[model samples]
Target: MAEKVVMAMSGGVDSSVGAYLLKKQGYDVIGVTMQIWQDEKRCDIEDKGGCCGLSAVEDARKVCADLDIPFYVFNFKQIFKDKVINYFIDEYYLGRTPNPCIACNKHVKWEALLARALFMEAQYIATGHYAKITELKNGRYALQMDFNNPKDQTYALYGLTQFQLKHTLMPLSGIEKDEVRSIAKEIGLKVFNKPDSQEICFISDNNYGGFIEEEGGKKILPGNFVNTDGDIIGKHKGIVHYTVGQRKGLGIAFGKPMFVKEINPLTNEVVLSENKELFSEGLMASDINYMAVESVKEPMEAYAKIRYSHKPVLSEITAQGENILCKFKESQRAVTPGQAAVFYDKDGNILCGGVIERAV
Candidate 1:
């Protein structure tokens, strides 16, 4: 019998092509779409940039039928709300920004669905993430950048464990986005020209503040917008509506441009300051997960990326007590709390990553 592999299909060209490629490679492919978020009354099937909906489920089923593969839609809505959505709202309420995609990839797809694949006797579980996993000389697995794909998703996969890396497969690693769509077209997949999802999967309209308020069951009260020196300058709509490095919509006619320097949930104060205050020389991160190696025993030089789209900057990292401290060679702008700071080697290998607790 052929080895069985489970593919996480998102009803997009990337995943559809991924399934086609894996099936062609002689594996028994099973397509699974996660029903992560669905509120039939409120969610519109025609939403511009959502990943999960009635339409996406239908599209995945159609692709699976065309490929003659078995398809399944597992309901993960409650788990998503408990793990990813709750964390997102809690982070914002605690005066920090959170990346829900990272949490979803970690807790939902890799953990929950990987276990499901194991139950089905599947040898490996795969996704269309633009990343690669290669074996190191030490017989360990390393997550590396996908050079052929411009949109690198290694940042989101940083939470994956070593065991998960060994069992996971990313078929889209060596292929470019445009070429993936081309392959889907060539294979006669109906979603060959589907647009990529841009917004968060759960937030249909992209109103993050509104979603937080509605789901979290708490109203964000207006807070005082103060300067760094504790001088009240203006009133903010709410703490959840602002983030670090935000420069607009302050509703304050300050003489010059002012940015959100910090958010104080304790005193309900949003600190506004000049643009220069947003830059930080370093950051402190906790919940570190290392890859390509077991742990960081000494201070090592590496390139660090503060945000998903930011370019990697040179930095030196040292293992502190229960946390890691990253000192950049130069000041990095808007090193926000609760966002990930992923470290990488010169060869584009993911060293490790952690949550930003504070700016140094």
Candidate 2:
């Protein structure tokens, strides 16, 4: 009997084509769309650059019908709210910027969906994430960057557990983004040209502050903008409206250029300094998940990515008590708290990752 695979179709060209690819690979593919959007009209589906909406369900259903495969809609709204949305609000409230997509991929996509697939007797769950799963020489599963795919997603996916990686399938690991689109087009998929989802899917206008207030039921209060010396320079908007290294929208003008150097949730202070102060030699991270190894007993050479858009930098990794320390060879800029710090080996295999707690 063929192995059963659940393909997560997000109604985009990548995942749509991913479903087609899985079927052609001789697996019994079942198409599934995660219903993460709320019942109320919180976002514009057509304008969404990412995924999740009524349209996503219909699109996935169409793709499954075309492939002669079964389709299902999984109600993941409660879990999403608990794991992704609430976590986002809590982090911002605590004066740290959070990546909801990363949280969604970990809690919703893998943890929740993988559990559901297993209950249904499915052998594996798959997504169109532009990453490759590989077993290291140490017999541990880890994610590798697909250099062929321009939109590499290994950063957001570094938190995947070993079990999740073992049971997950990425059919597009070696496929380029353009080729995925071409396959969708050749197969007559309507989402072949659909725009990719960019901003937070639930936040249409990207007003994170307003969304946090509405959903979190707490208003983000105004705070003080302070210099590195602890002197208050100006009154500013709420802390949630700003992040480390933010220069624009400060609504205050110093004599020269200035940037957000840090944020203190305890005192509700948004620290400002010259652009140079944003650079840091190292960062302290917590809640780390190891991928290619069981643990890091000593400092090791690796490449560290502080955020999604950042190019990886040469770094040394060490375990400091329950947290991890990433000391970069060259000082990096805007080492923000609440963002992920993903460490990769020399060959670009994910070593481990953790939530950045603070810059050292």
Which candidate should be chosen as best, given TM-score against the real structure?
Answer: 2
Worst 10 residues of 2 by lDDT: 38-47
In TM-score terms, candidate 2 sits at 0.98
Error (Å) of candidate 2 at residue 331 is 0.3
89-181: candidate 1 lDDT, tens digit per residue: 999999999999999999999999999999999999999888989888878787897644568899888889999999998898867888888
Query: Compared with the true structure, what per-residue lDDT tens digits does model 2 show for residues 47-78?
Result: 77457888878878998898789999999999
| Cα lDDT listed for each candidate | 0.88, 0.90
CA shift at 140, candidate 2, in angstroms?
0.7
Candidate 2 stretches greater than 4 Å from native: none
| lDDT score, candidate 2, position 197 | 83
In order of appearance, the predictions have TM-scores of 0.97, 0.98
